[model samples]
Target: MTDVDLTADPLHDSPALREFFGDSYDRVARFAVMLADQGVLRGLIGPREVPRLWERHILNSAAVVPFLGEGTIVDIGSGAGLPGMVVAAMLPERSVVLVEPMERRTQWLFESAKECGIDNVTVVRGRAEEVDEVVEADVITARAVASIDKLVKWSAPLLSPSGEMVLLKGRSAGDELERGKYVLRKHGLVGSVHEAPTLEGLEATTVVRLQRQG
Candidate 1:
């Protein structure tokens, strides 16, 4: 499959989007389009469902930028780097580690990072639960990864004492949070959910932030 044609007009010269993304706008947009064209996303979500590349994918991913602090970011189950690689493109100051067990997806993440000239991202090929290492990060992000309960257990050790876990969930975020309450308490992490802006009829996106207690 071929990469998306990023030189297309609308995205190439949109002042508003350019301002929002800064110098990294074009590269991030290009990466989104490339994923669509290359069929990488199609394998998981299918072609027709691919939302508007610039507004829905890139912008939605970039929206998380403001919440991230300077440090390492570990993206759990980064299937094609939705917000992970997208964040890396926009925030060069932060390091992004994409932890995906699937070999194919990990390969794609690595290739996409190289293609986008994003040096701060590293793709690790392993499941989140099995890989036990003491890599404390300032932030941990997961998009459509799993239930909040499972995620907490999986990501608890990866976070530093002050690190925050930002999980992306759909409308059922509240339900997930409730389901994960037991695990959250057991792990000594306080959890809260925030609403993200709507995109492509996606009414509510949830950002679940968790911090470790003393």
Candidate 2:
């Protein structure tokens, strides 16, 4: 994993973030700043584990915003609501659900969403595999959740027939894709991987898009 610069200013002002992301940009930036200022994220995962507010967390999360359609999104294992909360803050038109199994983390997610003033988000306290019946989402996202194979199994049922699964992964994404080929084929899913440039200049990050095969 690339070491994010904690001291440097990663998230810019509301106007700048808004200009970059449009209307909801300010809310997203505010949320990131609030997380840092309130020490919610740091308290949950320590200061060392928290990513840079703007670069690693906000922008990294926003990179996938373009791929999501104007439908519901379900984020599995939304620890600290990384991309889930960020996505909700950025795109209020779409409904965002953060699925977390841990009670403490779920509580933190709701608190963060409220503090961020994001009304489009909902917190579901349950594991991905157990709550598929209730969550029929157009897009399923998982960041640092599980391996590709396992994540596919967990997210499959929640996805709409035309839905896609987007997984945030690091350098070993290709390896994971290769390892998951058999499973993907068995599940009638085909995957295409896209690499997003990281601010840290370390290993490139990948956003894997998996769609159901006909």
Candidate 3:
């Protein structure tokens, strides 16, 4: 008998995911398939990530969709387009810009957006701090990109007057927030952490929201 790897079928759909994604389910699912197939080869996501692509990467990325209010969204260091492309897929009406430094990664993003039929996506190849001044963002998002302090510094310039940074963080979110308090204050920003929901069984995503001090 041959052993079958269930993880190989990462796009196993669930009621919660279908309900959450609604009309955008097909596109997001296609994107996931692409990642599972080419993510490691393109050096975007590690091979180990393929097993839990839906829970860890796709659904976790979708957690940010609720908090994203009106206007353009800019995702920094959007390797494999985690929340960036995911967000674009879910919210087809909203403009989502993916900023990635590597040329190959940028190509992946562009190709994924095109092949997945995500029309609201724009791929920009540049470091977060070096992105063009014309690209003003109403909401900025990033996942596993950098420390809180560094993220704030890199995202500050691109933010619009009332823009906020909602970053996907991990268990050390609070500690990072504490350490970054000074830098946040220096940038005239304030930070808070929230537990954003994905599916019922899976752990909630840690999101750190940073906005200018009013």
Candidate 4:
């Protein structure tokens, strides 16, 4: 995907995102095309998802970047590095960990980061439940990883006191939040649902934000 053309890219219309990630425009764009073409071929992305890779996948992942504060990011179930790789490509200054137990997926993540020119990413081979001992992060990111309940159980221990879990969900985000409310409260975490901050007039992604309760 080197030297890919960016004319009329769907993300071009999102000035706020573009301006925020201005320096990483090329890297992010190349990563998107690579994920759509090569990533699909490798069984990383669904074949039918190629057409929507930009808005539905890459942009959706990158949308979470704006909501993130400066700190290390741990991405669980980092299959194909959805929000992880995309975020790593855009924000190279931040430490991004892509955690997955599958060797195939972790291998792809390492190679993909190299191909995408992302230097701030580290690929760790482990499940979300097993990495807490050595992995502490300020923000935990997930996309289509697991149910809300399981996500919290696996991710909570890895979060620092001020850490937040930023998860990407579909239209059922509100429902998931409601269903997970008991677990959130049980774990002393507060949950809120918000429209993924993205370009105007576009179908926004849903975000579930969780913070440690006082």
Q: Highest lDDT, which number?
A: 3
Estimate the lDDT of model 3. 0.87
- TM-score of decoy 1: 0.86
Q: What is the lDDT of residue 12 in candidate 4?
A: 42
The pairs that clash in candidate 4 are none
Task: Give the runs in model 4 whose Cα sits over 4 Å from its true position.
Answer: 1-20
Candidate 1 clash figure, as a count: 0
Question: Which 10 consecutive residues of model 2 have the lowest summed lDDT?
Answer: 1-10
Q: 7-94, model 3: which lDDT tens digit per residue?
A: 4644466666788788999899888878878887888878788787788889899998888888999999998898999999999999
If scored against the real structure, what TM-score would every candidate get? 0.86, 0.86, 0.94, 0.89
The number of clashing residue pairs in model 2 is 0
The 10 consecutive residues of candidate 3 with the worst lDDT sum are 1-10
* Candidate with better lDDT, 2 vs 3: 3
* Residue 176 lDDT (model 1): 83
Taking the tens digit of each residue's C-alpha lDDT, what string does model 1 give over 1-214?
3433434424444677777677887677667666767743437445553544555566666666666766789888888687889989988877888889999888888888888788899888887776658456789888877888888888888877788888777767888888888898888888777776633444445577777776
lDDT of 4 at 175: 86
**What is the per-residue lDDT of model 2 for residues 69-186, given as tens digits with 9 covering 90 to 100?**
6589999999878789888888888899999999988888888787668999989999999998888889998887899999988878898888889888877888999999998998
Clash list (residue pairs), candidate 3: none
- Please state the error at residue 98 of candidate 1 in Å: 0.6
**Per-prediction backbone clash count:** 0, 0, 0, 0
